[model samples]
Target: MDKQPLLRNLETNQPCQPLSPQLLSMAATAAYPGAPQAEELASAPPAHLFDNVTGYEGTTAGGEERFVPPPLSTAEGAGRHEPHPQGAWSIPSITEETAREAFIEYASSKCCYSAKPAKEMVFRDLKSCNTYRYRLESFTESRSTEWTSEPYKGQFVDSSAYGPAPLPWSIIVEIPQLFQDNIEKVPVPHTSSIKGCHSCMAMGRRACTNCTATGRVKCQFCNGRGYKFDDRCNRCHGIGLQCCIQCNGSGTIPCETCDQSGQLMIYIQLTVKWKNNVLESVADQQSGLSADLYEKMIGQNIFTDEQVRVSPIVTFPEIQINQASRKAIQEHQVQLTRTSLVIQQRQTIEFIPITQVYYEWKGKEYNYFVCGVDNKVHAPDYPAKCCCTILCAVPGDLPMASGGQTVPPANMLDKLAGYESIAADGEERYLPPPVYPAYNAEGGQPQSNQQWSIPSISEDTARQALIQYASEHVTYSSRPAEEMVFKELKPYNMYRYRLQSFTESRSPEWKSEPYVGQVIDSSGFGIPPPPWEVPVDIPKMFEKNKKKVQVPNTASVKGCHKCMAMGKIPCNDCLQTGRVKCRMCDGRGSMLGNDTRCNHCMGNGVESCRSCSGHGQQKCDVCQGRGQLYFYIQLTVKWENNKFEQVIEQQCEFPTQKLSKVTGKELFSDQQFQVYPILGFPDPRINQISQQGIQEHWTQFGKTSRIIQQRHTVEIIPVTEVQFQWKNKEHSYFVYGTENKVYAPEYPGKKCMIL
Candidate 1:
């Protein structure tokens, strides 16, 4: 087992390391005053010396806390008072007193004592029962905190499936007349549903007039040719014909009423919803919204102006729009919008009671804390004493007879003081006590010894005897436990935002195109018409001229030629053969005894032509070599490039905004002490005394005699606590919150007849 360190350094606020056991000082202090007796000083068992020293079955393998001896209680010396146990002073007194006087004649006529003269002396203990006072001033404190809030308000936009046609598109609408000029056609549902389309050629029953009921036409791609590029008309398989365009080889057209699926499309409503966030504020549980927030909240775009407002919402009247509330005489339309604001405020109080105590005991005054009272004394220092009463009498003896009791000598009785005694014959008798001991410096009580009397207390044992006497005066008193509560107002402030909900969904405007006949137009396409006979046409210009010239000739001969610049042709100087016989030497081995040509041809018997070096022929200029002349004509045709119009869909949109709110709250509690009314103690004179005795003596005993005295009081105190709660409520609202939405539609492309 391990033990926690007892003390910590105030500066570091950390546990102080344990010093060597040798560092520990003497345990005695003002708190533990008065050394123990010799027997009590015996070595204490290790179990009592420190925690974990003995009876520890725990294993040391685990880490343990270091134990440091508590710094010898230096706090004891300061503000030190008499050493006492807890609740000792607070213990009440439980003692009562009784006194009775009675005089009675002896049962037998002859009496040994005087009945009438017999007196009952009652000794009353006087205790003011006044107590020490105490005041427990309550000390309370609280901690507060604040922070910025995160806005969690926002709009929830949901688009659900169309229901019952709130607003819908219709398939039974006017359609453009394909391949026809200047026409919009509306077909009868009953007839057009079953009959073939007029121009489209529906269900195989209707023969295509364009294809002559054969559903075929000439193969324009191959011009009725069987092969690719006029080789074979693969597209028509040599038939030179193909399926008709109008019938698409089906010999029939699709009906528009059924949309070619044999089933008609049904229209339903399309609903859009705009809602606020459902979650609550993280800082507080209060709702950031109020019924009034919904008032005048409907903004533009939620509902169309054409779609009459016919009481859309009535369940919450506060949120309902009041047409009469419009101050502008209802001339202008209402535009609903929502926004939130933060409302802030600040609020502070103190509760502490006064308390004090005063007390006195044994002629000594103390500010607070009780030690003795209630008709009882806490004299742990009272010395024990044993005194005997002696009845004095004149030195006279009764006649020695058979019925008489034995008596001691008058010389022995002469030492006695304040003792009363009697013989069987009713005559008083006496016996003497031993001489008293010498007086000590204190001179409180005298000591004497006698064989027939109680043993005398020795001076050496005076202190021990006084302390032991405590058991005789010790007593107990009771008091009930108590509690108290003190409170004060603490001011606080808070800020927050509120949110209001208006119309979840609405349309501010409804736009529709009026019915009008529209003709398919391709005239804007810039396509020109082509004509062959008796027709006006545009002709392309051409500029051409021809010219011819004769050739110089053709030759197969070699070098120095236009086509053959070098190589493979024999040198002209050497004719068809390469050897020139060395012009300088004229075929001789040497000229004038020197082989000049040999040096020129490098010892080879051949000569190379500079121009056609040693080759026989010259190059021909005409035709470059042995060739022909070629000419080509370049032609470019130009006209207007057809520009076709592209089909594109148009787009439109509306803008809207979302909103939310934030909130916060605070609360606190702390403990403090409270002091109630002061408590009471018993007065010795009024309260009862259970045990009492008195002693008077002689035999050299001084005229002075001593008695015990004491007094005290108790204080009452209890614990208490204080608490507080604060809250700031607002609402969850929105800004820029309208039936914010977006929608788009597609239109089909129209076509005109081919011209």
Candidate 2:
């Protein structure tokens, strides 16, 4: 039975296509030795699954028009002799002076390192190794398929209404342009059908696995005991049982397979993905430098070629370059062609120069490498490290005495005597002498004449604020504000500007559900209007809203898949038995170890299933007991108002976030479809912010979402810093915004205990 053709050409009555190379190889390996039979090749999966169609058009099994990708073209002048241009192949080395400066800068950047080595080291030798890098990029497209289903709403069944279903590989789908990374999913034409939901076996609900169809479980809170610690259990009210939460005491849950519609719309989904694959190979330089370092360096591009399929270079001076090119091309084709179709191929060769400088310092040899067009240096080891201590002395200090005997000050003599004794006795008794600057008796005074436009609150209002703050924090006391002194208040004004861009965007998707009673819109049957072209009422600007509208003419009705047109299905809870074990007695016909008859079951071992009410069947939920569904495409329109704000930095020590919470005085306001930046504002920073906000909003959201309206406003938030003296100590508090909110980080009353 397996050795038979799954499909045949309608005209010739022969096999539709030949077996793939992979399938043929598998058959060759599985065939018996000396056997001449061709049955093994025919036993493989259908040829369409792996067909390599090399055409732009084809016909589906149902004679419907389909799209087929064309084969890749060969690169022009491939595998031909290409002469190198004069002076383009030369590798230049950097001068010694340039190498020294780069090394000196490198040494100076390290901590506790001296530049003596860089200055004194003599150049011994310099080696230059030029390496070549080969890179290949293949842009390809691949396809995959999967079976998906939705609730069987009254949707048009394409296969039932049209002709036979098309093969998966033969379905027509519009492919996006090649060499770009993209993903698309297309439904196979004439493949959609209605089928019974296999999940619940056409049942609208499934047995509650949590309670095992008993509708009740042992009470978790009371541990199945009627009483708890000599008292009746409150959770179960002495019944020692609780209704199943999953089934809501019905012993069954709505079937998820059919979405409670009791049917599904089954179809094959084809996913086409376009991807760019990159592969690189570098020629072995043997320069003792890491290949990864050369990769970061930009090399001279001696050769570049791009085409549908690139051939390996055969006439290059470097044998390694020719070999690497051949290997890369073969590997790319072998790896990508098995699962995907190559649309284009690009290959290039780069020649990077590397210089290794050998130098001598302090009778030892040291080496450093310079790489790339930017002359990046890599030096891990450098000689001449210093750990010298710096000392600061007062002016006009005593000079060193004759014979290197230094004359110390009287205070220094005491510190030195203790230092020597501690060192001789290994004791930590010595202390470093402290250096102090000459103290000035006169100190700066606080500014007293500054006045605030926004005055401080009255004593009564401050008291109420203290009480309100105390009520929120259990540990805080309200007694401090009553006695604290009022000090000077200075206001610092902060400016803020906010810009809002309100945009509306629409996205469309296919949706289906069990067909109930719904108005059918056949006007939108053909190609629906583009999202931007569709006319929709724009709501008030800056207010977010979302609405879904069905596309006209896209709706169709199909039979229910889950219940198979049967309005009802067997109840999963009872499994068509219409009965379940009694929960009170655990199917023992009695309670308390079979000593007493169970009151709930009247001595019966089983009770009727609550899910179907003893009928042993349930109404299909997917089709809503109608066993049909309606399918259509829907457009979701979403409105979003994006907000951008900028606040000028204030010189004072006020928190910027605090200003945002309070109301401010609006200085300037503008609203339009596309508002221009403010030209003449009192604060130059506000004008700059306005321009930046508008430009940034347009760049970030203009492409993906449609802009409906733009509005910008500037506000001045007044902030005051108040300084007061309390118990000979200075304290400060801030008052900001039009609301007069206070920010007192160091309130003097907070440090005092009221108790």
Best candidate according to TM-score: 2
lDDT of each: 0.23, 0.63
Off by over 4 Å in 1: 1-214, 218-220, 223-230, 244-248, 259-755
Q: List, residue by residue over 1-755, the lDDT tens digit for candidate 2.
A: 12333346889987544234355334434543433333222322222322222221132322122333333435433463442322334455687897888788878887778888888987755666657788888898776655456678788766535655565546666667655789888876766777655444456665565675668767766766656777777877877777766677887778766777867676655677789888888876677777677668877776778777777877665677779888988998788876777878878887776778887775356788877666777776766776655666644233422211122112211112112221211111212212222222222311212222433445455445545544433223555555556676566778788888898766655455777788755434455444455567888779889887865555666665556667676676777788988998889887764355576786788998998899977887766788666755565778888888767877888657555557777766777677777765666787677778777877776656777788888777877776656566777767666666667655554321112
> Model 1's lDDT to the true fold?
0.23
Worst 10 residues of 2 by lDDT: 417-426
TM-score of each: 0.12, 0.38
Model 2, runs deviating above 4 Å: 1-92, 96-125, 152-157, 164-181, 359-365, 380-755
Candidate 1 Cα deviation (angstroms), residue 342: 35
Model 1 C-alpha lDDT per residue in residues 513-555, reported as the tens digit of each score: 1112222122133221211111222332111222221111111
